[model samples]
Target: MEKNVKQIVEQVIKDVEVKNPGQSEFHQTIEEVLTSLIPVLEKNPAYVDAKILDRLVEPERQIMFRVPWVDDKGEIQVNRGFRVQFNSAIGPYKGGLRFHPSVNLSIIKFLGFEQIFKNSLTGLPIGGGKGGSDFDPKGKSDNEIMKFCQSFMTELYRHIGPNVDVPAGDIGVGGREIGYLYGQYKRIRNANDQGVLTGKGLTYGGSLARTQATGFGIIYFVEEMLKEAGKTINGQTVVISGAGNVAIYAVKKAQELGAKVVAMCDSSGYIFDEDGIDLPLVQQIKEIERKRIKEYAVRKPSAKYFEGNKGIWTVKADVVIPCATQNEIDLNDAKIIVENGTFAVGEGANMPCTNEAEQYFLEKGILLAPSKAANAGGVATSALEMTQNSMRLSWSFEEVDEKLHGIMVNIFKNTRDAAKEYGFEGNYLVGANIAGFIKVADAMMAQGIV
Candidate 1:
């Protein structure tokens, strides 16, 4: 980057930090993405002249609301809700609604900002936005959960529509939450607006294979990367963090691909089964029983459960997929994986690896699949769901799976080619950021300043 351009970019970043105080996650992502785009800014002064980065860093709209609901105990409960419509240059706002207690403006902004590029890479007509509440669904009763969802939707419905913004599930949000929220949306609008949300129950408007999209998509992206390296998933030892929907299905797909998944985890802890994780047992424990990962050890004596989420990175493996959450893997975790000779790390969770960890993987020459490109399966399929809803037709599981496979394969090739084009050959972090950014940038430029 030229000295003058560098100063300009630095000033923009400085302005962001000064304006959005205490938003560490948002600040981290902004620094990581804009720094990677320095080459692009240098090569094309139009983006700088138009102040693309300045406009991009600031969300088009940010909604914060207080959600008050009655619990099963007839007690009033309150939580904060947020919806960050980060960008919509190409299409409608597309992203997920998280329900974790950890959700905040910074986290939502980070996810939404990353979604701008992720959706662009899909080659689908969807932009980026995210919304959710800081309501933990862990121990809540079904009725209580429904009450919370209904109350959250009462305020959110005004800001969303099929062609405006569509939200899906993430973290503490899932089928049950989607169902409740969708029901409330229907009640408020007095009309069926199925496309207004994704991840709905199959009996409603949800697309087939929607549940498996992210996990399966991660493997599909990884498979292409491995093939480029003249390797395959077969006979590889895999350790995945998180035993949620993403991790469990990733285990299923990887096992089907002939890889031995040795470990999986939850917020509480992780379990290691060297002989290979029994997919059925894990599915039963997590999906059906909704139990902690520690139960895997008790049920299967061969496996061992270890407390703490970070320790999962220590176990040696050929591949490591972080399906847990943002910043799950830091520089130290990257060191452990690189030292252990783990060659590839695919992210199933959004921004699962910190900037330092991602840089370490790149420095070590590991085949790293960044989250925006790798985990785009979920949102891509959500777009498919939107299509199904619009057309009033449902495709079979096999059809959706095949289309998803094709999309993931294309994402890998696009990311790779973008890296080669920008003199950052094989650097997917840069490649993904650049590839995802260019499409949106062009669209934004065409649309003019909004």
Candidate 2:
């Protein structure tokens, strides 16, 4: 990187850090993305002249509100809600609504910042934004969950619309939650706006393949990466973290491609089945029964249960996909996986790896598929759902799945091509950041400073 360009990037990082104090997550993402833009800034002086990075780092709008609702116990409960409309240069604000106890402005900003690039990679007409509440949905009754969703949408609906901002599911938000939120949005607006949210139930406006989009998308992207390295998923050992929607479907797809997924996990612990994980049983425990993954071991004699989620990385495998939360794989986990001869890692969650861990894998020549490029299928399909709603037509599952596969394949090619074009061939993290950045940056530049 040239000295001038490097200095400009450093200054932007310092400004974001100072402005957003105590927001370690937001600072981390800003540092990562801005640092990667050095090469671009050196070659293209127009971006810096326009002060694009300064405008990009700050969101157009940030909404924070208090959500009050009645619990099943007849007690009044309060939670904080957030919606960061980061950028909408290309299209409307499009991202997921994550409901977890860990959500804060920093986390939401990080996710929203990353979404700008992720949505761009999908080749869909959508921009970046993200929202969620710091409410823990665990152990909440169905009525309680509905109450919280209703209270959340009461404020959120004012800021969001079908063509303005569309919110989908992430973390604790899913079909049930989306249904309730949509119901409340309908009641408040007195309009049938199916396009206001994605990930809805089949009888409603949800797309058919939306449920498995992220997991399947990751596999599709990984498959292309492996093929470029003269490899395939056949007869490979795989270990995945998380037993939620992303992990479960990722296991199913990898198994279908002839890979033996040996282990999977929930927040509590992981279950390992040497022969191969039983996807049906995992789905039952996680989806239907909503039990811990340890139940898999109790039900299947061959499977063994571990006490911690991080221990699953110890198992040797050809591929390791972290479908869990951010920074789940630290430097130690990366060292262990690299030492165990893991060939590649495809991220199924947002920023699932720490900076040091990602660096270690890249140093060891591991094939890495960054989350922005790999896990874009969900949002891409959500865009497809938005299209169906606008057209008032729905497609079959196979049709949606085919479209998703094509999008993932194209994302891989574009990222790979961008890396090669910039003399950073095989550095997918840089490639993804650059490829996604260029598109959004071009759009930002075309539009006058806003």
Candidate 3:
């Protein structure tokens, strides 16, 4: 690290440590962003001099509150909610709200911090923010889940708007949560503000191809990458972790592009079907049934459900998409994937690969696409959704899909150019950081220091 960077990092760490008191997740998020921006600092000394790096590292605003709701059994339930509006230098704060048992201030901050760069990488007119709750919607009745989302959004709606902050779905916060939350926002605001949200049902002003954008976008970028690598998804065996919307969609698109998806896992475990997963069956079990991956195995007797944490990364395949959670694939797992002849790794989840795991791939000359660039399709299409809402028009699926494809392609081009410009050769991680930070940093400077 450069002397100035080390000093800046130390100062920020000291301030965060004093305020957070042993919050490792927040530290990790800040560290990752700061570490990746060294080249940016070298390229643009003004950013470091203005302390823009420090300010960028810290969020502009963070909202935390207690969400109390009634369960199906009529018991009082309380879960924490948070919205970290990390940065808005480029545009309005835009990101997603996730609801899961693991959500917390630290986690949400990390996510928002990451989104600052991720949204920037899309080259769209949007900034970055993230929010959610520790409320687990799993096994909860629809009514119970609706009640929780209502409670969470009642506080959140006041802090967000179409032009201020636009949040979509993530992880546990899927269509159900978005629907409940949007309903609450509409009720409270008493206006037909469809622009206030994204990820809506297509019949209700949502864009077509929105559901398939992220997954398809991943494959599109990977396709461009495969061409560069002298390979293709056609006839390639793949192992994708996480059976959530992102993972499921990635599987469908990868298969559509002629790859064979052999595995998908949930929190419970992984299900491996050598016959290639039935997308419809996987959808029914996950989207409709909200069940575990192991259930997919029972339905197919020949399949195996490794009922533990380490089920993925152990599988041998040509490509591995870690769509699960942060740090789900570490150095050991990366070594396993590399040893298993895995040539490509695309992150569908934010920060899914640990630094060590990423290093393993970089050292081995493996093709790597970070989540910020790979999964940016969701947010890019989201910006299009916002435009449609503002214009009082809805585009057909083909229109939005074409626009999304163009944006993803452009994102790859920008990332590639950034890498080459920075002299890092094929380092997309550094490329993405530098490319993303420059736009936001320039905007922040133009807007004057706060």
By lDDT, the best candidate is 2
lDDT of 2 at 239: 95
lDDT of 1 by residue, 250-302 (tens): 98899999999998889898899989999899889999999898999999998
lDDT of 3 by residue, 1-450 (tens): 478776776777678768776666777767666777777777677887788876887789989999999987889999999999999998889999888898888888888888888899888889999999898887888899999988998899899998899999987877767888999999999987898889987767788888888888888888777776788899999998998888888999899989999989988788888989898999999888878888888888988889875767788899998888888998889999999999999988888988778878999999998888888999888889999999989998889989988988888888888888878767877777778888999999999977
Return the TM-score for candidate 2, rounded to 2 decimals: 0.99
Candidate 2 minimal-lDDT segment of 10 residues: 28-37
| Of 2 and 3, the candidate ranking higher by TM-score | 2
Clashes within 3 Å, all models in order: 0, 0, 0
The residue-by-residue lDDT of candidate 2 on 1-450, one tens digit each, is: 499999999999999989999999999888888898889989999999999999999999999999999997789999999999999999999999999999999999999999999999999999999999999998999999999999999999999998899999999999999999999999999999999999999898889999999999999999999999999988999999999999988998999999999999888888889999989988888899998889999999888999999999999999999999999999999999999989999999999998888889999999999999999999999999999999999999999999999999999999999999889899899999999999999999998878
What lDDT score goes with residue 364 in model 1? 85
> Which regions of candidate 1 are displaced past 4 Å?
none
Q: CA lDDT, every prediction? A: 0.93, 0.94, 0.86
User: What would the TM-scores of all predictions be?
Assistant: 0.99, 0.99, 0.96
Q: Judged by lDDT relative to the true structure, which candidate is superior, 1 or 3?
A: 1
Global local distance difference test of model 1: 0.93
| Pairs with backbone N, CA or C atoms under 3 Å apart (clashes), candidate 1 | none
